[model samples]
Target: SSVSVVICSGDSVFLEGAYQYSAGTYFDTLTGGNNCDSIITTILTFASSDSSLTAASICFGDSMLLQGAYQTTAGSYVDSFSNAGGCDSVVTTNLTVSSQLSVQLSSDTTIVTGGSVVLVASGGASYLWSTGDTGSSVTVSPTSTTTYWVNVSDSLGCLGTGQVTVTVLPAEYLVYVPNVLSLSSVNLEHTRLYVYGRGVESLELIIYDRWGKKVYESSDASATTRSDGQCCAYGIGWDGTYKETGKPLNSAVFVYKLTGLFSNGKEFIESGNITLIK
Candidate 1:
């Protein structure tokens, strides 16, 4: 009589008072009830075992199932399952967890009308701004206070977002005065000390030296609209010189008083110090 049996690798099956491990045929001799020798044939085979290795990744704050367990960190893991022959079907997992996505903008800021501000975003592989811009930095000139948003993505497709508010200063009797003047530069605009502003229908500018004596004064009411439609009062700027003579003035600090009237007939006044550098 012949019999067949299957077992797993590294395991044995008992047959005819002996253990069988490898796939082969064996012969056993046993005595029958009639006292005659009986021959027994045993066929042994090995069952199929399974092993696999896999690599997986998950975003931060996310989980993945492996070996009937949830993993959230980066590392290697192993699991075992029983096959039909009760063998260990081993599975190895090499998992990697990505870092959390974070995005930061430059700052929420304020800018004068007709002026532009640069907004920057960091800690991202790609960026998309609300202005339909796709760069990490964008320039915006909003007519009014506005909020801008940016969407960022990492190489792993992880997403993050950031926003900034830009406050646009309203039109008023505004003026810009320079504190320093450079005479060495060839640029005429550099040497000329000009007070720039908007909404001024009439302007009076006076400059005084260290002494109380006034060195220059202007009542020029000439105003022109800039290309951007903002009014700029030209009013004959000073050229680092005395009004009496066309000679240049020495390097020193000078005090100035500026008074004006807006187009709406509102009064405006300001005083500041200026340094003339030769």
Candidate 2:
């Protein structure tokens, strides 16, 4: 025999020899309230489950992969997953993104003294140089070696600083001395020979007659220090005259000794014969 009964959705009922009962009717043998053999039935029902979660934050211009798919736009996404109940569960994800920050400066460079070079900054909304300027590029001419720094701010208000060193090369040295000078007429003071070069520290020239007698000498030629700190550059020189009376020397071949010091601490000594015209 069969009996009918109502049950809530997803609920299960039992039969005589079965544990699971579907939406169909079942028969069971039991001692009804009358203590006699009777039949009863049960039915079962089930429902689906789902869930939602927020995804972690990610940087701008970067993508996130979910369930073998890539996504960049910020929004809600859904994918099916197997739950412990052996059912397909729907999972929703909400994504959040942020902006990226970057900053950089030009590489280091080498320059000679009195020479200038341009430095550039990049990957920023604004820039400020250590030299008190605000711009994307700056020109620097340092007497000696120096390092310059630039502070950069990104669109997201992120700040970064970078530096580049500028190495300065020493000044060049060059000089020229005349082999002969006239001491008579218009050549009096014009005959004076001053050290000449791009960087002359100090120079001293002495004159002597054929007899080896010192005819002219100026300052301490051996002094390590020069009043003018440049190489091949000095205003002091010999006027082709005697040391005592400032008298012009006679027209003759005279032996001269020259000692020069350079700004770089290098020294040179030269001795040669110079002709004097009377």
Top lDDT hit? 1
- Candidate number achieving the greatest TM-score relative to the actual structure: 1
CA lDDT, every prediction?
Answer: 0.82, 0.67
Instruction: Flag clash pairs in model 2.
Output: 10-45, 10-46, 199-231, 199-232, 200-230, 200-231, 200-232, 200-233, 201-230, 201-231
After superposing candidate 1 on the true structure, give the runs of residues whose Cα lies further than 4 Å from its correct spot.
1-3, 27-40, 81-87, 112-115, 173-278
Give, for candidate 2, the lowest lDDT window spanning 10 residues: 219-228
Deviation in Å, model 2, residue 53 alpha carbon: 99
How many residue pairs in model 1 have overlapping backbones?
0
Q: Please report the TM-score between candidate 2 and the true structure.
A: 0.32
Count: clashes, candidate 2: 10
Range of the 10 consecutive residues with the lowest summed lDDT in candidate 1 = 224-233
lDDT by residue for model 2 (98-186), tens: 65555677776655578899999998888999998899999999998899998887765556778988766565744345667665546
